[model samples]
Target: MFLLSLPFSLASAAELKFTNADESRAEFERSVKPFLTKHCVGCHGAKEPEGELDLTTLDPDMKSSTSGARWATLVEKLTKGEMPPEEKPRPDAAGLAATIDWAHAESKRANRNFTRRAAYENGNITPHSVLFDPKNIPPFDGESRVRRVSPEIYETFLKDAAKRPGTNQPFSPLGGTTFKDMGDPTIDEPVTATLFRNALIIVEGQTVHTVENGKIVKWNGARELQPLFDPQVAPTDAQLEAAITFQFKQILKRPPTDRELEKFVALLKRNMAEAGQVVGSRYALATVLMLTEAVFRMEVGSGQPDEKGRVRLAPREIAFAIGYALTDKGPDSQLLAAAATGGLGTDEGVTQQVRRLLDDAKTDKPRILRFFREYFGYDKASYVFKEANSGGGTIDFPGHDPGSLIADTDRLIEYILEQDRDVLRELLTTNKTFVAYRTAADWQKKLVEARKKFDAEKKANPEKYKNREFNPPVKMVCEAYGLSDFPEQQPVELPKDQRAGILTQPSWLVANSTTFDNHAIHRGKWIRERLLGNVVPDVPITVDAQLPNTPEKTLRERMAVTEQAYCWKCHQLMNDLAYPFEQFDHFGRYRAMDSVVDIEATAKLEGPRRNQTKRVMQDVPLNRSGLVAHVGDASLEGPVDGAVELMHKLAASERVEQVFVRHAFRYWLGRNESPGDAASLQAAHKAYQESGGSMKELLSALLTSESFLYRVPASPEPNAVPKAASKKANS
Candidate 1:
C-alpha cells in the first residue's frame, strides 16, 4: 500500500529485457545471480539449506528450463519478504524489490497462469513486524476472492430446503491455528461427484412412506415434488417455474435469474423426457442444490474496478459476507432489505448494518465465540487423546468428565465477552474462572442437604407433597471435574490461585499437552506466533523433531536435544516462554512434586487414594521459573514465575493487543494482512485503544476499513509497491 513512486529499478530492470531468451540469461548473470550470491546464499545454499530448496543452482530462465515450476512455487516466498527469514540476513529494500520485480516480469513474459496464493492461503507468510509497524500504514489490502460455502453452511442449506438435515458432509473444516471461516476447497471431479451424491440423498430422503393397507405410516416431505407425483396429468411450464422459484428461495436465498430460470426449466423437461415426472422433478431440485451460487457465496466485488484497480463489493455480497462473518445463517430479512435498498454501499451504511446485527441479542453470534475458541486453541482439548478406562494409565481426574473444563473455559470466555471491556486482557489475566457450584467434591454433600430439607418440607405438608416429584436443589455440575448433572445458568467463582485466564485454564493446558507431558515447546510456539505475532520457521528437515521421551528425565532434560546451535536458533524462541507452564502437568493439575504425576480427582473418589497419593504420586523438586523474550518490548521481556505471571505480562502489552487485533482481522477479514492491509490493522487498533478496548468498536472499525470494503484483483504498477532500499553492489 505504500504509494508506488515510479520505480528506480526500471532503469536497472530494463537492462534485462526478457524480449527473448539470450538477453535475459545474460542479465541474470549480471544482476540476479550475483545479487543472490551476496544476499541470499547464506541459508538457501550449500552449508545448511532450509525447506530442501537449493537456490545456488536454480536457473533464472523461466522461458525454457524445468526450474520454471520451482520458481512458481517460490514466487510468494520471495515477494512476501519471507525469504532470508527473520533470523537470517536480508537484502535492503531496493535490492529486495529489484529481485521481486524481476520475478514478476519474467512470470508475465512466460505467460504462466500459476494459481495465485492469497493471504488466506498462508497467514504466517507476512512478517509480524512489517504488519504492525505503526509508522508505515499503507493504503489497504482489500481481499478479492470467493470462498465456497463451508460444509456446515451447505448442510444448513439442505435443512432449509428439504425440511431434512444433511448427513454426507463432504467439506471437513480445517483445525489448528487456521481460521474456521477461511478456506478454498478445490471443486474438481471427485468433489463434484460427492456433491451430486449428497444432493440425491437429500431429495430422495423427503418422500412420504406408507403401507397400502394395515399399520401406521411414515411421512416424507417431498413437497417440491408433490405436483409431479401425479403422472396421470401432464406437467406444465407454470408448475415447473413454481418448483424452480421455490427451490431457489429455499436453497440459494434469492430468486433465479432469467438465465438460471430457463436453464433449470430446460433441465426438468430433458430429464422428464428420459425418466418420468417424479425422477425428473427430484433431479431438478437436487441440481438446484448444487448450483455454483448455492455452493459458494461470492465475495468478488460487484462493480467495475476503480482507477487503482480496487473494487467494492456489491450490497448483496456485503450482506452475505457480514452475515456469515458474525453468524451461521445468511442475512436476515432486515439485512436483505438493506442490501436491496442500497444500505450497504457506503462506509456509514455498512457500519450501521454490522452494528445492528452485532447488537441484536436474539441473533446467535456464535462466530464471535468461535473466534476466541479458535484463537486460544482450547477447543483442541478433546482431540488430545488420553485413556480413562485403562486403570494402569493415569486416570484423567479433572478431565474424567467429557469436556469438563472445556465448558468451564467456554463459560469464562462468555462471561468476559458479555462484559465486553478490555476483553483480550480480561481473557488473559482474569483470576475469576467458573468451577462447579460451591465445590466439585461437595456435590454429594449438597444433594444430601437438599434431600433433607425436601423430606422435612414433605413431612410437614403431606397434601402439598402428594402430587410433586422430588428434585434436588443441590445437584452435580457435570463439567469442571463433574460426575453428575446439574442445571445452572452460571457457575460459581473459583479462587485466584486456582486459575488465571484462558492460558491457565485446565482445558487449554490439557489441549496443548503432548501424549505424555505438557507440550511446552508447542505452547511457547503458540504464544510466539499467536500472542507475540511472530513466525517460528518450520523445523528444518534435517532436525529430528521428536524429543527423547524419557519418563526418568524431567521434560527439560529430555529437551536437551534442542539446545544444539542449529536447533537452539528456533528453540530459543519457544523454550523459555514455555517452561513456566511446567508447574502444571498435562492434565493441568498443579505439580507440587517435579517427578510425580499429579493425582487426579477421580482417582481419589473411586479408590484408596490416600495410599495411592503416597505410592504413585512421589516426590521431586519443581521449577516454574521462565523467561519472556524477543517480543520487541524490553519492559515485557523478563523472567517470570509461572503461566499466571506470563499471561499478565502479555495481557498488558500494547504489542500483544495489536497481535490480538491482527488475529481478529484474520477471523473477520478471512485472510492474513497483506502489506496494503497495514492501514486497516492500524485503524482497528486505534479504535480498540480509543474505545477502551471495546471489541464492538474494534470490529466496527475493521469491518469498515478500506481492506474490508474493497479489493485489489491483481498486482498493478500503481499499487503493490514495495518499501524501497537503495541498490546494492554485488559481491
Candidate 2:
C-alpha cells in the first residue's frame, strides 16, 4: 500500500510544480527514496558502496561525510550515460529519462548550494571565479597534469635507477584499492585506460608487489596499497651517493666534491629515520615515491605565473634540456643534475671542453645529423635511399665505404665538424654530397655507357641531337672521361650547377613528395607549413582517386581532373612551387622524359608577388631549366648567384635565427614559448646572429637565460610589489 501511495504522490507532484526550493527538496526525497533504496542501496548503499557511491543520502539530508558527497556524484554519472554501465542491467527508457532529469536538477541545486556557502565564507566570489571558470582555460601549468611519464622519459629513468631496461610487457602505474577507486564517484574525474600497447611491457615472469605502510607485501596479500605499481628498489649507499654526485655534476656542468657528497649521504640516512618496516625497503620506497608521477614532475608555484613572468622548468624539463643540448645518445639523469647546479658553465674553459669533446670525428656525424633532423626536418643518418633485394625497408648509405675510412670514432666526428663552409648554408643548398666512393664509382660506369650510345645516336641524326643538352656522365665515368669532357661529374670539383637548395635537394625532394611525379599542391603545402609557418589542412585519401596513369601529365593536370568540382584553393600555391622542380623525377633523379612520356618539362616559375615566370634551361620547352632561366632573367642576376645571395640573407635574418632558437627552446625546456619568454628568445637570437649562427652559441645563451636557471617562472611585473613602499618604510 505504501509503495502504491508513493507512485500516487509522485504523479500528483508531476502535475503541479512547486515554486519554493524547500518544497522541491521535499518532493525529491518523498518520490525518489523508495526506488533508490530498493535498486541503488545494494551496490551504492552505506556499507559496501560500489564505486564509492551512495545515492540514497544526498544534499540537505546528507552532511559533509565522504559517502554523503557520493550521492551528488552518482546523480552526475547516471545522467552522463556512464553509469549503470555496460555490465549492469540498463534502465528502461522511461526510467533512464526520469533518472537523467533528476540528476540535472540535483547537480544544479548542489552547485548553487556550493556557491552560496563559498560566497558566505569568503568576502567575494572573485577568488573562486579565478580558479573555476569554465571558459578561458589557462594552459596546463605543470601541476597535476604531469601525472605520468612519457615513454621516452620513462625508459631513461628506469634504466638509470633500476639498472633494468623497461619491459615490453604491459604495465600500469595504478594498483590495489587505489586502482579500484580510481574514479571517485563523488567527483567528476574519469578512470584512465590501461597503459601499454604493442606488447611493450611484459609482466608474465615478474612477482609484482604492493608497498603499504612501508611493507613490501606481495600482490593479493593482506594489506592493500593505493594501487598496483612496481617501485624501484633502493640504491646502495655508495650508488645513491654516486648517482646524486653525477646528477649534480651534470646539472652544474662540473664535478661534485666531498662536501656535496656528504649532503646526499645525509638525505639517504634521513629516509631511514622514520618509523617503518625494513629500513632499506623504506629508503628504497622513498626514492621510488620521489620518482613517481607526483614527485618526478616537480611543478612549483600555484600554477599562476610568478613575479618575474616566467614559469621555471621542472626537473624533468631540466633533464630534457640538458640531454638535447649536449648529446644525441639520449637523456642521462646524471647529466641533467649536473646542468641544474651551475656545473655546466658557459665560460671559455667549458666551451673549449665541449668543443674538444664534440670534435671526435666518429660520433660527430650522428650528433649533427640528429640536430639537423630536429631543427631542419632532415636526418641523413636515418634516411633510406634504396630498397634492398631482400626487402623490408629502404637501405641507407653510410658516409664512407665499410673498409675505406679510418676506423676511429673520433675521426668520424671530426670529419663532419671540420668542413669550412657555413653549416646553415650547407643545410639549405649544397649539391656536393658525401656519397660512398663505391656507389659513386658504380654510377660513373653506367653513365659512361649511356653517353657513348647518346653520342653515336647524335652522329647518326644531327638535327635531333645538334642543339639538345645531353645528360651529364656519372662521376666515375667522368674520372675515366677526363675532367674536360664531363667536368660536372668529376671527383673533387665544384658542382657547375648548384641550382637546387634544400627544397630541391635530392633527399628533401624525395622526402616531401608523395608520388614520383611531384605534386605541386603537396610541395606548396610543405613550403607553407614547414618553411613559411602556415597550417595546411589534410586532404582526404579519396582525393587520390582522381589521378590517372598518364606518366607525362603535369601536377596541374592531375588536380584539375582529380575530383568533381575540385576546389583549387591550395592547388594554386602548390603548383607554383612544384613546376620548378619538375626537372627532378620521383626518385629525385634528373629526368628528360617522365617515365615513357616526352617531358613537357618546361615551366616559367615566377617569384612571389612578381609579374612573370622565370625561364630555365630546357630541351623540351616544359622542363625546369626554362623556368629557372625565366626566373633568372627577371633579376639579370643569374640563377646560382641569386640563390647564393638569398641563402645568405635568410641565414643571417634575425627572424630565422629566432625560429631556430625558439624551436630548440621549446624542445629542451618541455614548454611552449610564452610571451614572457620573448625577451630571452631575442637574447638568444642576438647571440646566434653575433656568433655567425653557430648552434653552440645559441645553446650557451639558452643555458644562461633566467628561464633555464630558475625553478619557477618569473612574474610579469618584477619589482612591482604591492604595499612595497609601506614595507620599505617600516623596515
TM-score for each candidate, following the candidate numbering: 0.74, 0.45
RMSD of 2: 20.9
Stretches > 4 Å off in candidate 2: 1-166, 169-290, 293-307, 311-320, 328-368, 374-421, 437-501, 540-549, 559-566, 592-621, 625-658, 670-674, 706-731
lDDT of 2 by residue, 162-266 (tens): 322444312233221101101111111121211221111212112235567765566642122212232445446665565555444322333556875676566
**Cα miss at 319, model 1 (Å)?**
1.1
Q: What does candidate 1's lDDT look like per residue over 1-731, in tens digits?
A: 22223334334533434676666666567667776887777766976564435688777766434355446546555654445566677566666656755665675566532334334544554555556767755555465677787766766655654444444656755443258667564576777888888777777665444434433244456465555545446668888887788778876778888998999989988898888766777787789778877778787786788886789988888888888888767788887888889898888999999899888999888778888888888988889976553233444452343265677788888888788899889898886666543344465676788788989999999999988866643332343422235534454444565556888777888889965578888898889878887656555434568888455567877777888876786788899898888878777766556764345533454455453433234456878788988665777899998777888888889889988888999888776766678878888999999888888989889878888788866545543334442221110
* RMSD, candidate 1, Å: 10.9
For residue 305, what is the lDDT in candidate 2? 48
lDDT of 2: 0.40
Score candidate 2 by TM-score against the native: 0.45
Which residue pairs does candidate 1 place in steric collision? 94-725, 140-676, 141-676, 141-677, 207-220, 208-220
Deviation (Å) of 380 in candidate 2: 9.5
TM-score of 1: 0.74
